[model samples]
Target chain A: MTTHNKIDPLGPGYEGVAGKELRFRDVFRDTLRAEMNRDQDVFLMGEDISGGFDRDTKEPLDAWGGPFAATKGLVQEFGPERIRDAPISEAGFVGAAVGAALTGLRPVVDLMYFDFVTVAYDQLLSNAAKSRYMFGGQTRVPMTLFARSGAGTGHAAQHSESFYSMLAHIPGLKVVVPSDPYSVKGLLAAAIRDDDPVFLVNDKKLINLTGFVPDEDYVIELGKGRYMQRGDDVTLVGMSYTSVVCEQAAVQLADAGINAEVIDMMSLSPFDEDILLESVQKTNNVVIVDEDTPRASMASEFAAVIADKAFDHLDAPVKRVTGPHSPVPYNKGLENAFMPQPEDVVGTVRNMLGRD
Target chain B: MEISKEKLEWMYTTMYRIRRFEETMLEQTFKGNSMGVTHPSDGQEAPPTGVCAHLTDKDWIGSTHRGHGHCIAKGLDTHAMMAEIMGRATGQCGGKGGSMHIADFSKGMLGANAIVGASIPLAVGAALTAKYKGIENESVGVSFFGDGASSQGVLHESMNLASVWKLPVIFACENNGYAEATPAWYSVSAEDIASRADGYGMPGVVVDGMDVFEVYEAAGEAIARARAGEGPTFLELKTYRYHGHFHADDPKKYRKPDEEEHYHERDALKNFEKRVTGQKLMSAKKLKSIRDSIEQEMLDAVEFALESPMPDVEALYSDVYVNYSNPIFGLR
Candidate 1:
C-alpha cells in the first residue's frame, strides 16, 4: 500500500525551501524562539520553564529549567519576565493565559505533559473555548496550550491517554497533533499565531524524530489536511503519532501488493473534511486509524461522516483501527496490545480490501 | 462612618431587591418553571451588593454560580437577567447562558462562572490588562467565590500571582459556612481563608458579610488601595446561606431545625433598617417607598420573562462559534 506519487502540498507550482533533518524538540524551541523574536506579544509560561537547567535543586540552574527541556534557553533570550514560572498551578496560569489572550498578549502556556491537563480542563474547555462565543463576539482568546501526550514510554496512566477527541468535542477548541518535526515546527508556529485557542498535543515518541523543515519561519494554515502518501486502492486517514504508524503499515501492505493513500489530519477540530472526501472519492475505499480509544474516537466520527457523504463512491465499507475500548494498561506488553500498532493497521487494510 | 441618607436608602433598597428576587426565583423553581441549574444568592446578598456598591462602570466583578445578587448589584437589566434565568430569548447572553453563567461584559459584569475557583485568575488577568493598558482611571477587579474555592489551588496561586505582580484584584470569599453539601469547617484546613493572605504578602480582613456597612467599608478601603497601586486584598465575608444551596434541595438534614431561622434573625435588610432609622440617616417611610418601587420592578421583570418567547431552534448553534460563518454540519 505504499505508493509514491508527486504531490505539491506547499502550493501549486511554488516549491518551498527545505533544510536538513531537525529533531521535534529542537523544532519546538526554534519555532517558539522565531515566533517570539518576530512578535513581542508572544510569551511562554508554565512550571520550571524559566529555570531551564537544574531539576533536583529547583533553582535557576541557568535559563530553561523545565522538566522536558522543550522550553530550554527561552528565558535567557526572552528574559524571565516573558518566560514565567508558576507554582505548579496549571488551572490558575492557564486560565490567566486565557484571560490575557482576551485582552492583548498572545501567551503560549505549557502543561509539561498532556496528563497534567486534568488540572486545567475547566479553563481549557469552559473558559478559553467558550469565551468568544459566551461574550457574544465581544472578545477573542488567541492562546496556545502545548503539552506532550501519548504513552510509547512507560509514563503510566495519568500521563498517557490521548484525550484530543475530548477537546475536539468542544466547539471552539482547535486541536493540533503534529506527527513529525516538520509539521511540529509549522503547525506550532501556526497555533501560536491563530486567533482561536489551540490545544497543540505533542507526542513524546515523535520528540526525537527528525524531519526536513525550512530554515526560515513558515505557517501551516489550521483546518487543512496534508496527504503524505498517494494511492488509488484505499484512502487511509491518520491522526497524530498514529499517522506514523499508518505510514509503516502502508510499507508492509505494499509488500503484499496493496496500494493505500495516507492523509495526515494535523488539526482535529474544524477538520479538513474536503481532504478526507477527496481522498475517499479517489480511492473508493477508506480506513481511519487513530491512537485514541475506539469508542467516541475521532476515527469513529470521521468514518460515520465519510459513510454518510461518500457511501455511493465507496467500493467497501470504511474500517477503523484504533485503541481498544479499555484503559491503557500499565504493563508494556498489555499497553502495546491496547494501543493501535502498525500490524493492526495492516490487518485492518487487509480486511477492508478483502471486503471489496 | 457617617453614611448619607441617600446611600442608606439605596443600601436598603438593594437588600430588598435581592431578597424579593431570590424569593421569587425560589417560587419559580418550586413550581418547576425553570430550565438549567439555579444557586440562589438569597443569604449572600450583602457581599455582592456591598462590594459592588463601591464599583463604578470602569471596574469589573467576576461572580460565582450564586450570582443573581451580583448581577443586580452591578446594574444589570433585571428584566433581561430574570428572563435569562427562565431561558428566554430576551435574556442576557440571549438565553444561551442561564443562571450559572449570566454575563453582561459591557456593564463590567464578567460572566458568572459555574466552575468553582475558575474566575479568580480571570479577574486578576483583567486587572493586569487594566494596569497594562494604563487606563487613566485606576480600574480594579473583584472576584466573588465561595469559602470552598479557598481550598482550590487556583485560589492560592492567583492570590500569589496578584501579589507578585501587584495587580489590582480584590479576592472576595463569601464564607457561607458550606460549599454545596460539604461544610467549610471539614474541607478548609486553615484558620480562615483570609488568614492565608499573609503568605502572599497581602492585607487579609474578615467582615460581617450580613452588615452592609462593614462590607462596604472594607471593600472601599481595598478598592482604594488597589486603585492607588498599593496591591491586592483578601476579604473574607462571613455569611450564612438562608436557603438551600439551590432550589428544590433539602437543607433540613444538613442544619438544625432553627439554623435558618437563627441566621434570618440577623437579616441584612432588618439590620440596615434598624441602623438607618435609629440614626435618622433615612426615614423608615422613605426606605419603604424604595422597597415598594423595587418590588414593583421585580414583578414587572417576572412578567417580562414569562411573556418572553423561547429561543429559536437556530439559536442552539448561534453563539457556539464567534465567527462561524458557515455551519455546514447541521445535525438539527
Candidate 2:
C-alpha cells in the first residue's frame, strides 16, 4: 500500500464551508490527528492499528489505518511510537490503556468491535470505570475507549452490536454516540480531552455518512443533546446513527401532515434529561429510536423517564422503536429486519398518533 | 549485590511494619473496628518489599487483593492505610476503597485489584507511558500478583506484549501456594509460574520469597534490566500465607494441620531477623527498638482511624467524574 500524503484539512482554505464535507471516518481520523498534535500526551494503541507488519523484515510495510481506516495515515505522520499495534489481546491492551491513563498519557484504545468488549469487560469495568472513584478523587483515568457499535455491515453478532446501553449503565463512564460526521469530530475531540473515562461508540452503519465538519478544533459538550429539526406534533429521540433514521422518519411524518421534532441524543450516560423532558412536555407524544435490543435499552430508559416525570403531560403512551431482543442475524434479510428502520420509527410514531 | 547495613535495616523495618500491620488489622477486625474483609499478606512480605526496593516514586506498581504488604513497602502512609481499612474519610482511598482497593497515586501505587491478574496489563500500560514519554529507561512498571493470577490469560498476554514491545515492565508473581481455597498444585498446569515466562521470550527466575536478600538480589537484576530497556521479566517468588485467604476464611478445612506450623517455622520476618542478627549485621537491641517503634506507629494509626469522621453523605455523588455531575437515582 502506498502512503497517502497528509492534507491539512484545517488549513486557511478549509474552514466551515457548506459543500466541504468529510466522511465519518475522515472526520474521526482528522480529529485524532489534531488531538495528537495538540497534546503530546495522546497516543493510539490496538490490534493491527499500525498495520502491515512484515515478520521477516521486522518492519511495518503499511498501516491498514485500523479496521475501518478511521486511523489511516496516522502511523506515517506520528510514527509507530504513537500509533502502536498490539496482539489480539483486548484485556492486555485496554487494561494497559487504563494504566497508561493513570500515569499521565491519554491513550485512545480501540475495541475493534463493541461485541468484542466482553473479552475485556473486566478491565474496562473493574479498572477503568472504578479507578477514579475507588482512588478517592485523587486520580483520573482520562482514557478514550473507541469502538464501533450497531449492526448492518453483515459482520455477524460477534462483530456487530450496539452495547452502549450496557456501558451507559456504568457510573464513572461518559458514553458518547455522535450521529454524523460533524458531531463525531467534535464529540471525539471532547472525549479525548475529557478528564474521565469516555466510551465513544461509533456506529458501523454511519461510517460512510458525510456532513459539514469544521476544519478548526471544536468540542461538543458531553450530556448535551442537539435538535436536528424542530416541530410540535411529536418528539422523536434517536441515538448514534439512528438519528439519521429519525430525521428521515420526521420528514415522512411531515409529509403526512404530522409535525415531528427530531432530537439527537449525542451523549448517553449523563443523558440530557432536561432536553428530553422539555421535548416530551412540548409534543406530549414521543417515540425513542435506538439500535440496541429492547430490554434494558436506552430507548427503554427514555420511555421510563417520560412515564415517571412527564406522565401527567403525555397525550399518549411513550412509544419505543428498538432492535429485536436477539443476536444480530448473519443473513441479509434477517439482519435488515432485526435493525430499527425509518419505517419502524414512522410506524411507531403514526400508531402513537392514532393515524395507523 | 552486597546490601548495606542501612538498606538491610530499612528492609527489615518495612517487612516488620507489614507483619505488624496485618496482625493488628486481624485483631481490629475481630474487635469490629475495621469493616469489610482483608486478605492479609502476613507471611508474604518479602516479594513486594524486595521488588519495590528497586523502584522509586517515578516507577509504578500494580497490586493484587492481598496488597497491604505491597502498599506498605511502596512507602504509603501507614496512618492513611489504617484509616482506609477502618472506612474513615481520612483513609488512603477516602474511605471509598476499603482494604482491597487501597490506592495512592501520588506514590505510584496504582491501586490493588480484586480481580485476579487484572493489574498485569495495567502495569504494562504504565510502562508503555514511560516508554512513550521517552523517560530514558529511568522508570519501570511493576505488577505484583499471586500464583493463582498467573493462570489468568491476561498474564501471558501481558508477558508477550511486554516482550514484543520491549516495554519496561516486571511481572512479579508471589506463588503463595493457594488461590483462595484451591491449591496451586491443582489449579496451575505448570510446575513453576516463572517457567511460563520462557514461552513468552523473557527471563523467568524463581526465588525463595521467605528470604528478603535472595528476593532483593533477583529483583534488582530484573529491575536494572528493565530500566536499561532490556524488556520485561517474569519473577516468581515462592512464599506462604500463614493466615486464611481473608479475615473470615478457615484455612484448617483446606490444608493439613501441620502445614501452618511448618510455614510458621520459616516465617519471612523471623527468618530474616535470625539471619541478620546471627551474622552480626545488626544487634538484637537495634531490632527490638525498630519493632517497638513500628508497634507504636501502628497503634497511632489505629487511633487516628477511630477518631476520624466518616465521609459526608454528599461525598457519595462526587468523584464519579472529574467535571460531570453524577446524580444518584431517587436522591435528586
Summarize candidate 2's per-residue lDDT along A1-356 as a digit string, tens digits: 11111222221133444335789888888889989999999999887787887779767654577888778788888988888888899988899999999999899988889988899889999999989998899899999988988788899888889977899988888999989887887788889989999999999988998887665556878887877788899999999989999999988998999999888888897878887898889999999999899999899988998898999989998888888989999999999998889899999888888998
Q: lDDT by residue for model 1 over A1-356, one digit each (tens)?
A: 11112225532222455476788889888888888998888878888886643669644554545657887777767766577776777888887787677657788998988878888888888899987666555567888988888877888787788877888888888888888877887788878887888889997888888877666556766777788888888887888898898888889888888887889988787778888999899999888988788888899889988988889999888898887777667899987887788898888778878832
Q: Which CAPRI level is candidate 2?
A: high
Tell me the number of clashing residue pairs for each predicted model. 8, 0
lDDT of every model, 2 decimals: 0.81, 0.88
Q: Each model's RMSD to truth, in Å? A: 4.5, 4.2
Which pairs clash in the backbone of model 2?
none
TM-score of 1: 0.87
Measured as a fraction from 0 to 1, the native contacts recovered by model 1 come to 0.41
TM-score of each: 0.87, 0.96
